[model samples]
Target: MTVLFWVCTIGILSLFLIWRNHSDQKKAKERFRDLKKTQYGASPNRNSGEEALSHVSHFFEDHRQENAIDDITWNDLEMDSVFARLNYCESAAGEEVLYDFLRNPCRLNASERARLERQIELLQTDGDVRLQLQYQFYMLRQRGKFSIYDYLHLLDQEKKRRNGKHFLLLFLLILSLVCCIFSVSGAPLFLVGMICVNMITYFQEKGRSDAYLSVFYYVLRLLGEAEKLERIHHERLQETFALEL
Candidate 1:
């Protein structure tokens, strides 16, 4: 009877998980369609263009790296419209990286550029590969405008602020469990108390860490996307994907 109950419980949980995943995928697809419509209709006016240009200056100043393209070059080349047309990226990271690529075009050698062009041509022709990559990216879309890089840059400060209360609480909980198992008087009550204390501490710590949650979420997504991209049989993307990984 116990085995039957356990089997039924597991089956029900599996079905529920499948249903939830299907529902989430449906919602994501709907959102993707709406985004496509918006992207197609988007037209940045003079004011909007100026605003985008201003933001570009900040990225340049914040991240001083080589091969960075200038805003003037992008504007002169009308690459913003070009990017909008080609921007099928579904993740925040993918979109940001694509924007950065356009703003600061990579200084690829002639052979590398030719190889990349070939890969682009292949990507254009391969609908299945494109769709697979798009689906993966779509699932990684973040809920808010959180910058992974900015939060990562502040990791040192965050680490410095961390106290060892969680570790102490965990140690106490383990000791309480051992005492309860040893059949000591009042051990059960002590164990329960420790559990409550641990729960409270967990929530408090979780609340404190909530600010970094979105940043970490997007970073995980970025890593997942990079892993998927690496598996694609494209030599041109191998080095770039390696750098990302």
Candidate 2:
């Protein structure tokens, strides 16, 4: 066979394999999201879940109506309440309340949601959140380059690395992978580079759950060959809720 013919054939096969893998991964993600909706009995990202999760309704019902939280500021109390619930104790009772509130998720106004996000940021500004997440990573360190905690900490995700060292390492990995690919057409150097890049990107986000997911994905793929996946709690992903896990 001609050299060009072989090159074309190999290139086509590589493209086919890469595309297949990507399609499968995306499908898995969609299926996972749908499963979550079913299990939580609420739609993803919808506040409907929060409404059903409220525990205060009963308490407040017995109290005088004048002191009841009004529509405009109830969201604030919810934010504070979630924070207070998380920080003060790692109690299942509190979590049950959160779940109840989230089950019929309250419709937090856009401004209110943004405010809560800021509140989460301020709370995490001290760095304890990151450390606890890190400890989770180290605990699951045996799972190769990734960890279970990575899937749970989107807020700790590493940013895409832009540093000179990263670029240099990436360049070297790419060069070596390219040389190897052409010389030994069956190996997966490009995929290796992708794995490295994913890890780097995971760490760059630092405090994101996406970072944790990156590590989780890496570990699962490299070690566990895991098929099941779940999202971190909304608070963990957003730094909004304190968690015992």
Model 1 misplaced regions, further than 4 Å: 1-10, 13-16, 19-82, 162-208, 227-245
Worst 10 residues of 1 by lDDT: 44-53
lDDT of 1 by residue, 146-225 (tens): 44555666665775554587788888899999998999899999999999998988898789778688677767776777
Question: What does candidate 2 score on TM?
Answer: 0.24
lDDT string for model 2 (1-245, tens) is 69999999999999999999999977765664454335432223322244433433332233324434465565755654453433221222233334334423454567777877775575457344433333333323233222233233444554664478657666766776776767766347665766678578657656544555555555554232211112333454445443323
**Best candidate per lDDT, number?**
1
Top candidate (TM-score): 1
- Model 1 TM-score is 0.56
lDDT of each candidate versus the true structure: 0.65, 0.47
